[model samples]
Target: MRNNLISGLIFSFFLGMSWLTKADLYDATLAYQNEEFTLAFSKFSRLAQLGNADAMYNLGVMYLYGQGTEQSAANAFAWFSLAKEFGIAEAFQTAQLVLQQSNDQSGLKDFLKLQKSRLSNTYLLDSTLTKLKQHSTTPTLSKTHDVLPEYPDEAVRQGIEGWVWLEFDIDQSGKATNIEVIDSYPRHVFTASLLNAVEKWRYTGSKQAHTLIYHFATHKDEQYRETLAIQKKAYEKQLRQNIDAAERGVAQVQYYIANWLSMKEYNAYQLLRYHWRSDEPMNELYLAAAKNGLDLAQYRLATQLINAGAHQLGVLWLEHAAQTMDIAKYRLATVLLNTGEPQDVPHALQVLIEASNNGHLRATLLLVNTYLTRLSDKAQAKAWLRHGLIIDPEHPELLLLLARLAENQAEAKKLASQALKSASQRNWSSHAIHLFLQKLAN
Candidate 1:
């Protein structure tokens, strides 16, 4: 009877302990997500002592980044070493990087002895992704072969599936270099795997930044397949209906069908077209609708004609749409610039200025660029950027341009800081700004 009672108490004690550990991990993760790094560090530290692999890894990250703690490579390396023994593969990967960066020869020699005198096959990717592109291609690097990564165990167990977006550079020697994960749908689920795989990829190209997406899925891919099938069916039905309407002489529907017909093969497939009519040429319908003074139809017809190198007809159609549309004015100016020679450069500048006056920021930027480069008028460029800043004080690109134009480093830094803040508010890409800031800081 006493043994039974003792057994019950022991079971209850372990159950409570398990629950507390789970709760602590949840809280730590929540704190990290909330950017409360100090609280995360505290919770994760407590959990790490309890032999939680995830907590150990998190602690390493906090120390490595100086988040909620002073940056200490030794501390991060120690945490990662502990986590690596706990079967967290990422910990081992990072510890490799620590060895490379450590200047203490005696410590590295001892560590190498412990690690069997050789670095592991896996690599430690750059933890910071914003500067990944710059790191990869500024100089030359060694070439490598393709090696696919294994699927993450935790993600597979949880039935989680998503993708990670990475940016890197191809070195002159054709190696994939300085790879970093810029975005991940499920955050940490596939980061390690994506990083490992990209590290081994080789590209035969000159030094340049490149971006790629890695998708992870198991059973969940079927769900996406089903959803896409339904979407395709719906799109096909709409296309058929539009064709019927177009045949009945509806100008809008005629434009829609004509536009679809004129689209490239890949784009038509994206619109769910299993087949296109080879016997039928419907550009005439587009021309008719454009001649009838529909702005969208005119734009579509203009692009179609322009792509075929019928410059005069394309410009004529663009002018017709430009009469009533801001987008048309921007497109016309862009086309004129791209085609060069035989273009009315002065008239195009007028069109851009008129478009900018209509609140088209793209036109403003283009005109500012033209003034800066084509005309070598910094005054006009500065005035335009200042005007844009007045309209939208937090306009990120304008602020970035202002930063670039600033002669004083202090003013440039301030403008870049404001640009980063503004971009973050809108969830816009701030990687370029980060690079600019990094360059200035250096």
Candidate 2:
């Protein structure tokens, strides 16, 4: 009788302990979601000490962001590395981002070396580390092997010498297409010729599609010849006019002036809203500043809206900031691809291609999605997957997509199995991937 009573008490004690453990995790998630970083950090730290991988990851994020603690990239990296040991893919990516942001290339090299030594038994880690090593050594710009085109006679005569910023798509076969001159000097003399020449440039075939930018600069003397003093004055006048047009209203003008003064989006939004009604035309000013071309305003507005739980609006502003034909476009495309609507998919693909062409790591993942789902071009899809693997051999999304393709061919059930394991490792929330894996298991 005493033994039975003791067993019941022991079972109850364990059950209560398990419930408390689950409650603490739930509370930590809620606190994190609510931006109560201090509370979340406290809970997560305890959980992490108890050997919870997810808690370790959450704590890493808190440290990375300086939430409830001083920002410490080193600590963030340490926790993320620990999480990676338990196969948290997001932690691995976060560690890479933290290293990049800190400009700690030496640390990144050391981390990779450590990973290579300690996790040599793990195939995924070994493969990923190998690709990272190879990428670290590769040059950003590839040498052009195609025949060079002669400079346009008109451009030469006009002495056009500044760089012509050209944007184009490079396919899997290394063929450049959809060439467009984004910005250029002596538009009439150089734009068309620059576009034409870039379109004809050939590359060695790559498994992944990338965007490439070629800068064509004329000689210094030629640049002077291209410059027209009066024309330059007129261009400056036009730019001021456009700026004025962008800030036409008193409220709008005030917002800009305040933003310039304070560099705070929330303050600008508050001032603008205080002076103008929500339904008024002046609201367009905020939207334009958020989306049209201003990146700082867009980022600020997006951050504010996200904090306020206006996810859709926040996403729209972030998309605008990300799509501004700038470096941040890659970051914006990543967020958009994760949260935006179906219409955002193609735009995300375009930004991903641009970023990938520029050698951005986050953009590579999007390239896989672009080919597989956005482009819906099977051959291109296969090519991009192969290319992504070159950069990140164990990328879960790439593996999952390839597995789905193989399932269609009925040639490799083993790929499907491996893909399921990879997807699970990454915590991918795709219903289709899940259903396919279930079918393969059956």
- List TM-score per model, in order: 0.40, 0.28
Question: Which predicted model would earn the best lDDT?
Answer: 1
User: lDDT of each structure?
Assistant: 0.61, 0.52
Q: What TM-score would candidate 1 get against the native? A: 0.40
Error of 2 at 223 (Å): 63
The number of the candidate with the highest TM-score is 1
Off by more than 4 A, model 2: 1-300, 306-347, 359-362, 407-411, 423-434
Q: Residue-wise lDDT of candidate 1 within 107-193, one digit each (tens)?
A: 754653454212121111101111222233223333456776666766654444556756555544455543445456566888888
